[model samples]
Target: MSEATDYSRETENLDNCDVEAAYARWAPIYDLTFTAVFRPGRRALTAAANKADGPILDVGVGTGLELPMFEPHTEVYGVDLSEHMLRRAAQRVERERLSHVVGLYKMDASRMAFPDAAFACVCAPFVLTVVPEPEAMLDELARVVRPGGEIILVNHVSRKDDPLAALDTWLDRHVAPKLGWRPQFPWSIIGDWIDQRSDMELMERRLLAPFGLFTMSRIRRLPLSQDVDAPVMPAELEYA
Candidate 1:
């Protein structure tokens, strides 16, 4: 292991080294395993992004499975913690001629390099609980998204009375430390933050398909007064 990869045992929840090692393993087979499974959530995110104006940022854009889903006219910038995964995304961009994919950067979700309010919209799919501090990461998402724009997130919000709590506990103890994510993440992490902030508001919270295990949240940044961005169409609306 490299010096960076050798630091896995240093942090409890911030198993960033673990994350690095985990994705390095997953990068090769990630799309093969997760693409079909995660496509619906990506569709929901990109479809909303397509409706809005200006540029979009996809954080934790692993392998950029959602890259080609964007409209040709839609400008997109992607960032991920894993260079191993990004290589695949770069290849996909080249292979498919994704001219609208402006850039793919290796960056931390908690501390990005972009200027404040730099993007019209920022979307993070399956990323919140993966990082060491999800709230700080959420704050970063809020910081970069423009006042009238939005931040969209897709994640698994553990139920208060979760029947799978035991399974989640086992995963956190064994699997998540290796994977560098919190599988039984709570809704309060996102909700309480929104309640405290005057500038951010949760516009929508919708459960996803395939057993309703996933959730999508659309949050708008307040601007005193501005037209809200177009909302993401629901799965029902999509099929109807």
Candidate 2:
């Protein structure tokens, strides 16, 4: 096929395929390959979960790597779009006898079935960029988490000034379809979205290990009474 036609076909496939199919292929060897690189973020998430008040919701809980790390007394629920990944997670839960893991459902993060304020904390680890609609997923997370609850995210955010930025962008555009991740996704997308909301408070943003490509963010949901009309951050400041 011509180069343009090949590119068009690839884009079409990416749009049509659900994340599950991509992850299904990766599930079997995911832990072996990514466990080391993602260790710091997973540890941070576990620490956050241990300190959180009530039940926890782990969105995009691929292979349940962090499930066993949660405190034994903390009740944890996990959801993911990939059944194959969830199956691996289920096996881990059983093998480890991690009773703290209350559930592992195969569900889309953009439209979680849970009711409002269903959880005390909602976390998405290395997940934001992988979803089809990250804004919708965040909104759903906010809806399910209690007013005073925490929302944690651990993901890689592209930096325009980074030396690897150009290469990352090229890889994201050319290789992400086969690799199942958007390596060049910008932090501005989430930052801009969050800046317009009045319902959450930004608690922290810290870089993780492995060259600081990844970051961990903590946000606390404000009570309904605190909701207010706030001015959006300036375009230049959105990614700052």
Candidate 3:
């Protein structure tokens, strides 16, 4: 096959692997390969999560990975697009005897099934980078969270300090495609989307070990006319 034909074929194959199928394909080896690779994200995410309030929603909560980090008094809900991953998550919840403290659902993160203001906090670790269209997911997250609620995120982003940002761009375009993660958009830009709207406030930024980054933000979806006094920050979440 010609190089162009090969590329097209690969893209087509990746497009067919939805969350359920992709995750199911990786299920058996998922923990073994991803556990150590994601340690940075877990540590950073837990620190950010520590600041969020109870009644948390873990969107794209694959395999109940965040269960142990949840506070004992807090009620947690895990949602994912994969039944297989949700099953694993459910098993973990049962094993931990957290049936009373946790709930599980099979759902899409881009179109959340929950009601507006349904959760005090929303979290997703290492999920946004893999999502097909992250903006849609962010919009959904913004819509359902309560005012002053937090959106905690932990992600392995393309390093910003790389000279020319070439490595990051190349990884997104080439390496990520092979993994079925569309690299059309770099991962570092997530904060820009979160802070651009008037409803969210960037609260904290921390560097996770081994190169992950975490952000803790508060939501305030009211129109600008309603909150003329709100502060604004640069894309870096840096404020004067």
On TM-score, the leading prediction is 2
User: TM-scores across all candidates?
Assistant: 0.86, 0.87, 0.75
TM-score of 1: 0.86
Which stretches in model 3 have alpha-carbon errors above 4 Å?
A: 1-16, 162-171, 175-178, 182-188, 212-226, 229-240
lDDT against the true structure, per candidate, is 0.83, 0.82, 0.64
The Cα error of candidate 3 at residue 202, in Å, is: 1.0
> In model 2, where do residues sit more than 4 Å from their true spots?
1-18, 229-240
Question: In what order do the candidates fall by lDDT, top score first?
Answer: 1, 2, 3
> Candidate 1 at residue 139, lDDT?
92
Best by lDDT: 1
How far off is residue 151 in model 3, in Å? 0.3
lDDT of 2 by residue, 53-144 (tens): 89999998989899888999899989887767887888888888888988887677877778899999999999998886778888989899
Candidate 1 vs 3: which has more lDDT? 1
- Candidate 1's C-alpha lDDT? 0.83
Ranking by TM-score: 2, 1, 3
Candidate 1 vs candidate 3, TM-score winner: 1
Locate the minimum summed-lDDT window of 10 residues in model 1: 1-10
lDDT (tens digit, per residue) of candidate 3 on 1-240? 001000011223244355456787666667777777676676666656566665788887777666776767777777776666677777777778765345677666777668888877788877776777788788888777777677776665555663436755776666664464543345446667856776676666666655333333333445444454666555798665
Relative to the true structure, candidate 2 reaches a TM of 0.87
